[model samples]
Target: MSMIKKRRMIEIQQLQDDSEKQNVTRFILEALPQWFGILEAREEYITESVNKMFFCAYDQDRPIGFLYLKETGKDTIELFVMGVLQEFHRKGIGRALFYRAKRAAREKGYSFIQVKTVKMGIYEEYDRTNQFYQSLGFKEFQVFPMLWGESNPCQIYVMTL
Candidate 1:
């Protein structure tokens, strides 16, 4: 049987402790496999204790989505990773986490926010992800054929804040 989604009040904020890092790691492992199943060589960011800009979306204190941001340059922040639990998809949790990160970046005077993902249409899940970010005003910045190797061309999106 299909389950119903509950109307939720989600709070977005920076991840503040090792416990939250664990929570986000669990969430990503659970949520992203559907999209990134082929890429087993997971990056160190999620596996290690988060010592970077990390944020999460919580529903009554339970984490539903998480995002990590890093200052890639003097005036730009790169969205290193983001994931929303499968069951919580399409419920605005990801958007909440993204905007919270964007707000924080903007407040810190970052000139741009960028995200790199596997080129959109190559994967169904990432296609939706691209659409979501485009809806948030992030436009195509560049596509690097060798960034993640030929199979996983990296598409970078950017929004000028």
Candidate 2:
């Protein structure tokens, strides 16, 4: 059985090769400036993803979305970063990538999954991001008032596997 899934001409695949992960991570993040506008932060994500679990969603041969998972603890994993092309939003690519990552985490014996984002209401872009995570059953766990900065407070969301 393959982890690859295809629907509506979009396909999702888990990438194990480091270079491919870096390539896809850079490509997808570059395509999503609204979510990954900070050059420093985006570069950090791309570099870190090379050593994390990576999954990519592609339309034909064009990578459109990606998710990276990092182990946060013996029993916990975090969705370090994720993004889908703006044109592909609400079309299930993000959801598919998430479920794939979740399944992989459970198989690896992870008991909890978490993600962090800019706290909602501070920005419209992040408000949608907050809602997306909530729609996937992630519950708000905490808020770090100045984790990112005074303006971009960080909100953590978690789910039990």
Candidate 3:
């Protein structure tokens, strides 16, 4: 199946500073935890002092979606959080953010990408999340109980570039 192509007017760029980062907060907050299953799981973490990699999807000058990532190893990265405003979902914004991040990470010499979410049988939202990652060529790497507890059953997926 063909994935959506990013609109010509839309740009995906790395978040450069505090102000550009701040602009996407409202859009990120629009998605529920059921949607992306962020570790912070709320808006309060957007500005938190975590070592993060961010890419924002902008339509013209409006921030529509974002992806948050962190280095888990010298050559591996974790997709920490990602979301698009409900009105903007499935319009290729999230897919654009994802592929941009992947390309950037690969260019930076990272070979592996990983993202964690609530396991499939537990949350309906995360089931789609897992499927989305899989569609992008990520595979099930492992399932462990340490991070989010037993019921959550953290599912980790990995992709190699």
What TM-score would each prediction reach against the true structure?
A: 0.86, 0.94, 0.82
Which of candidates 1 and 2 is the stronger one according to lDDT? 2
Which regions of candidate 2 deviate over 4 angstroms?
Answer: 1-7
Give the per-residue lDDT digits (tens) of candidate 2, residues 41-144. Answer: 99999889877888999888999999999999999999999988889999899999999999999999999999999999999999999999999999999999
How high is the lDDT of residue 25 in model 3?
Answer: 59
> Superposing every Cα of model 3 onto the true structure, what RMSD results?
5.1
Cα misplacement distance, residue 68 of candidate 2 (Å): 0.8
Candidate ordering by TM-score (highest first): 2, 1, 3
User: Could you say which candidate leads in TM-score?
Assistant: 2
The TM-score of predicted model 2 comes to: 0.94
Model 3, span 92-145: residue lDDT tens? 888888998988889989989999877887877777788888888889889987
Error at 91, model 2, angstroms: 0.4
Q: Tens digits of per-residue lDDT for model 1 on 131-150? A: 98888899999999899888
